[model samples]
Target: MLDPDLAFGEPVDDFSHCGTGECRVNTLPVLYRLNQVISESSGLADALRIILDIMRVSLRMDRGIITLYDRRSDTIFIHESFGLTDEERKRGIYAPGEGITGKVVESGQAIVVPRLSESADFLNRTGSPESERRAKAAFICVPIMLGKKVLGTIAGERVYRSRLLLKQDAEFIAAIALMIAPLAELYLIANVEKVALETENLRLRNELKERYQPANIIGNSKPMQEVYELIRKVSTSRATVLILGESGVGKELVAGAIHYSSAASEGPFVKFNCAAIPENLAESGLFGHEKGAFTGALAAHKGSFEQADGGTIFLDEVGELTLAVQAKLLRVLQERVIERVGGSRPLKVDVRIIAATNRDLAAMVERGEFREDLYYRLYVVPITVPPLRDRGSDVILLTDHFVAQSSRANHKSIKRISTPALNMLMAYHWPGNVRELENVIERAVILSDDDVIHGYNLPPSLQTSDETGTTFGVSLESKIHAVEYEMIVEALKSSNGNVGLAANELGLTRRMLGLRMERYGISYKTFRTGTPPRR
Candidate 1:
């Protein structure tokens, strides 16, 4: 948490710029206080409140809410807010498909609307004045996830005539997600760990890791074949390369694939996400830092480049870099030399770069947001990981793989899925892709007492995929299967919907999933209801 703030600096004029240097300098004071709240705030509630407050002020919005994925309800709740009456805020519960925020949560993507009245994804559950929904300006909602699991979201709504949240805002928010993400994880992990300790006999932990390990990248489909082929081709290349794909598309897996199969296979394979690092220390992290480089620089430090000097440095989200750092990276790429921050000489390094990002750097470059030269540098040999929806049978193939893996790890005898569960997985939109599937399977593995996994154990998302967006689970059918739906249904039937113990029953892939009961019955309407079948 503190780390992201460290290298990222205070993000002076971070996302939205007013005028040139002068205007940005003036706005600094106000934004500084906002940053204080966002970065330095402690405790989950305080942090969330601070975030909403900051957004409300910075964006000049009438309302802002930070809804974290509530594990207890399997739904999203407006945990904190700015510019909303208590009466309305209290009614913040969002079923998977309830409204815009709900749908965005269900779809697990950011949505921007200049006018809600004209949008098809609008959900109006809060009972706010019609003007709140119809008012001019933009409403943007984005998923807040730490790697695979989605915690909740940060939504901003400007009052009538407010400017819309642009793609840049969404991208910036996406880049800065580290702020709320870890806290959400901390909250979820705390609950998980507590329950895990209580369910001493549960073997869900190992079950999850094994299923999501390098081996779980299952697929024989043409798209998968193409992925494998690209992985193979890139594996042999010494050229710097880039991997592009959405979250849960397994960019890291592809990173692993490239490393394990490379000539430098024996060499260390190190990974780092540029966006995850703080701006101030980003350079020192990627390169090295000499003693006294900064306040806490206590001693000399070797950065990632040096640590993996003889191997590969996988820069996940490489485009999150600042232009200054991009320039440094350019030098490293061209000269294979890196100078430690605060040091004089450039150290020679023999490392290959495999950059990855879901964002479009080329377009950013065109917009003068990203460096054109750096974009060209990273585009040397690009590899694409298609989303699960486009991968055909890869979903089933991967599902089968995870089920078996989970079964063995969990010490269960389950061999396969029942037709309904299989069909549900097949028919499901898989917005969260393989990662979501893995979580669902893990849940099902524990819930399944018989040889076959049943649909009843599936998460509400998978069980009702036809109705709403499943929120954060993978839409990429190409990765893992939904283990949550079956498990939740089974747990509910057994424990009678007692969320706590039910979640404790197992752990599977979709490693980032939390089975909050946000119904996916409708995204186009707030009048919809979430009706999960009773076990």
Candidate 2:
């Protein structure tokens, strides 16, 4: 008889009473089936339920239950069970040291109750019937542990048998617990990461909603307002948008605005550069390929169209696609289906197409460079984004936006762009458009020494000679003289009126330096008095 106060029953460790041959015969097949079930199961919960079922069937256990400890709640609840009603399973909750199941978890040891009818520790929380409570029964429970940490417990009840048989059964249950510890731990970790990823995805979706709003696009110029109006009208529909603009003119940005503002905002927005894909792989890249379709194609792939199934796909530089690829794209536009490389079945895709190009697609079609049918299909709603040079004072607005962004990124405290720098930015013809403007601002912010972006911080390409009023075709001799004059002035300021020191700095003799200064009308006497001579 077990002690009433020690409700944990008996700890079963030595199974020597059970012969080795009997143990091997009974345990080997169970272990093999458990391995097979675990390998074939999709998730931890499913695997655990199947495992409990196996125990009930093979070990002749009347009931089996698996419980997991929730650190957040500081309690153990039935995670999986067999031969127990839903109500009974829900009643099987326990805190550490609360019941026999809890005691096994608290001590991280196996427990065997030889006779349920006599043991006072058998709580019977699941409400066993009077007849079953009076019947001969043996209960076995073992802690499921990962290393030294107890994660949960597994328990079962069988017909009361010989003590030797109960010991053998307890040993087998303990071994099963050991095998599942790693899986349970992995399931717990995966659940945590899945929750974190869901939170992050929600945050990003909200941010995109705010960021890609049509009103958020910078520029109120007449051209931009017209572009905004077009975006608003077509954003609610499923029409194919053909964005016409020079390279780096924010065509992709406009496409993004349309996507996020549309009804399909919750779906993916896939971007593919038509000119960037290699010619030989372009079809495979867009339509995907089956495993063993070609060399090095080890597994099946999902292409851009399939990936953007219920969403939008922005095909930039669409005019650069080869004729063969153009035909396939035309078929997709017409039939709404795509066939993988070396695949016969056509996979249907519901995707909104948005194509952009800097080239003249109308002329390309005439010259046989682009497909005529595809050009018409993409031209459903043509939007021409004006070049930056054409959008007058919008330059100042964009410059301020870029400055603020660059300042925060580079950890600078830039207050404003100097008047001269602003003038240069407004006056220049931006061949690279808004993209080039952003790069120039980032460069100036990194090179700036103080709170202001000066004219000198601007790239040389933006610098024009005041005398010639032009950036190009300046005389070589004039350029040399301008550079020399600045160098000599800087040298004098550094030397503080010491002619010999200034000369040494410029790697010139004192006489040569003095002669050049006289010609350039620079006087070292002014520098000696802590004043720089004007050029």
Candidate 3:
């Protein structure tokens, strides 16, 4: 709110124009009040409202309204005003060039009507009563502009006793509107940008939630389907899950799916890698530590278990726990309580433990390295994540996923993978599993200059994993069959999809060539149509 006293600003006693008896309307007071309104306002709406209120009192204007233009809609509507109901404000919308006010905005000029009844363009969209409209003698409307861009309009009504007074009022309103135009345009731009950012934030959050769903885990093989079933069954209960798989086989992703799909999905999911924790810090890291519990322990800290009090705690590489820590963890699993280091009292924790390990915990227990009781407790809900080599055609699915992800992250436009490159990817024994595939795809996306990933774009290790002398467990018979199939397909392609010509080129009778095609699942006519050979 603008202070009414600021507009008067201690009246000037010595009048400058002394000859005339009629006193001049002092505008210095209005200018000072406008300055205060701009400086003391919190937002654009507040500034415009206060300015309109102050101008009404100083200039004896009535029914002051401020409208803003929407470029997408090509309309101008009253945003803020002194004398309008909510319904009336809604009715004040006007298309560009529709009425007198619209004409002012479309032409980027001001309009001053000396008699309200004389102007046929007036729509009376503000729904002012007939009595008030009759009392109003003059109407002044000006375009609020930023450079060549006309942003909106400011309009008011006043009693018309003299044309000179009406002209003076119009000039004063136009000057004030010019002063506020830039800020008004800035406010609209900032508001549009803010809305866009918030919408994008919501979209990304939804994408993250969908990514953690079990269906989006990216594998369709029997092994992965079995894993999904196990996750679904176990997610309904609070059982202790034990995820077992080779390194880089997406153990954490499975755990995340379980946690997010479970009954306690709303709770926090905390994760810690036992192998990454040092021997000295394992105890405090899992069970927390009290203030002054050890050297340099100045403040009390919540550990992984405490942080996951009502949720889930995923302890990766649980095989690395020492004998002493193993005993404490075993007690926690059985009793649902953990005592902090250097504290005698035990605190109850309602956390679900989802433990993972690449090493065989059963063997470790037999060797007296891991506790036998803890192994059985965690083994109650065991889930085995399959390695990449065992997942068959799922390699192509994962490859496509990683390619799309990497293309987006690197701002590249790679859309497809060459057939030879895909064949190499499928044949390689991925010792590093899915993680390695993702890294390879990211590297290829960064290194490739074209829209497609070619065989040469792959790292040398993957390129040689299949072709290096009886490597990758591909049997000699299988390789011979593949070579035979390729040679026959190429011969058919060269002979323009003629079976007899192809048979003669391969040194075989037509009957033998047909039998080989049936054995290899090859279709001879597909060659001339430019379809890839199926085998």
Candidate 4:
């Protein structure tokens, strides 16, 4: 609400500008008051309402309305109004070029209706009474513009007066509109960006949910099926889970699947590597420190447990915790509470613990390296993730997944792995497990130039023969021959076993290619039949 008799700052003494010898309005005082209102207002909506009030009071305007354009709906609706009921304001909606206000917005110009009764362009959409409509009321609308872009329109009504006075009022309103144009544009841009970011955040969360689902874990081997079953059963419960696996066996993936599929899927999933933290800082890292807890502790920090409240926390390599930290961990497991490093209060936490370790905890217990009570607490539901060598043909499935993934990431067009490459992948012992297989496939994808992963594209370690136990004796000449053999085979495959075409692709004469094929025991007939020749 605006005071009807609001003072427009101190009065100016000059009154000679008006030919009638009366100073009804001063532009400088009104402009200063508007600037003060704009600067003191909290936000765009607040500022707009007060601005319209200022115009209605200072300019003696009977009614004022500010309409903003909504780009999404392609409609202009009254955003702020002065001297209009809520119901009347709700009725003032129009499209661009629909009415006088719309025309001002569409043309990016100011419009003045000298006589509302005589003008056909006046819609009277606010449902003003017939008496007011028929009275000598004038309407003025000015487009609020940022550069050439029209954001909306500011319209007001005043008693019909001389043409010069109406024109002067329109100019004053247009000047105020220009002053607030930048603010309006900034508010609109911020709102659009906020909505866009929220939409993107939702999309990424859904993608993560789909990517980490148990069914999407990328393995169908019996061992993997068992792991999946255990994950499904324990996911619905709040029991502590212990995942046992050798290094690089994807214990972290199993933990993630459990967390995202559980009831607390929307909560945070925090992962802390116990082995990555130093032994001295282990306690403060697991259970956060107070602001002045240590020499360098500058701020209070929330540890993995507190940060994972109402969620799941994955403690990888849990066997690496020292005995003292293990005891504190045991207390947390039993009491569901943790004490910060230098804080005396025990904070309650509702996090589900999923611990993973490559070491044998039972053996560590016997050797007095790990606490027995803590081991039993963690052993409640032990899930052992099998090494890659034991997963059999699942390696082929994982290999295909990694190859496609790496190809897309590296902007390559890898069609398929060659038969020899597949054979090499299957024959490897995979001591480094699934992680190693992904690295191997990524390496092969990077090295492949002909859209096919050949045996020669693999690293030297994976090129060992079953009988020879080494990769072609590590000589430069042997490596060259290996690459040459792969290239010749690939050329034959691409040329559909046409000797002359294959020879041409390999930059060799027909006779020379025939000699080299014979030396490498390569037969083109098998390639013609779409069967890879024996190496």
Indicate which candidate wins on TM-score. 4
Enumerate residue pairs that collide in model 3: none
Error of 2 at 218 (Å): 1.0
Q: What is the lDDT of residue 375 in candidate 4?
A: 97
Candidate 3 local distance difference test against the native: 0.79
Could you estimate the TM-score for every candidate? 0.48, 0.55, 0.54, 0.62
TM-score of predicted model 1? 0.48
Model 1 misplaced stretches (Cα beyond 4 Å) = 1-216, 465-535
Give the distance in Å from residue 470's predicted Cα in candidate 3 to where it truly belongs: 8.8
lDDT of each: 0.68, 0.80, 0.79, 0.82
lDDT digits (tens) for residues 470-492 of candidate 2: 34323567556655765686678
* Candidate with more favorable, higher lDDT: 1 or 4: 4
Candidate 2: misplaced stretches above 4 Å? 1-190, 465-535
Per-residue lDDT for 1-535 in model 1, tens only?
A: 1112212112223333453221223434654554565566465666665565556555456777777665555567666777777646655666676777777667777776655666776665566787644455557788887777678888777632212224445555555455668767776666764533423322232333234334556777787788887777777789888899887878888787777667775567788889899999899999989999888999999999999989889999887899999999999888999999989987999998989998988889988888887888889988888888888888888888889889889999886676447667777777777887788888999988788877656776665444333323445441134444445455544545444554566553222223234431211121122233521
Clashing residue pairs in candidate 2 are: none
Top-lDDT candidate index: 4
Q: Candidate 4: what lDDT?
A: 0.82
Which scores higher on lDDT, 3 or 4? 4
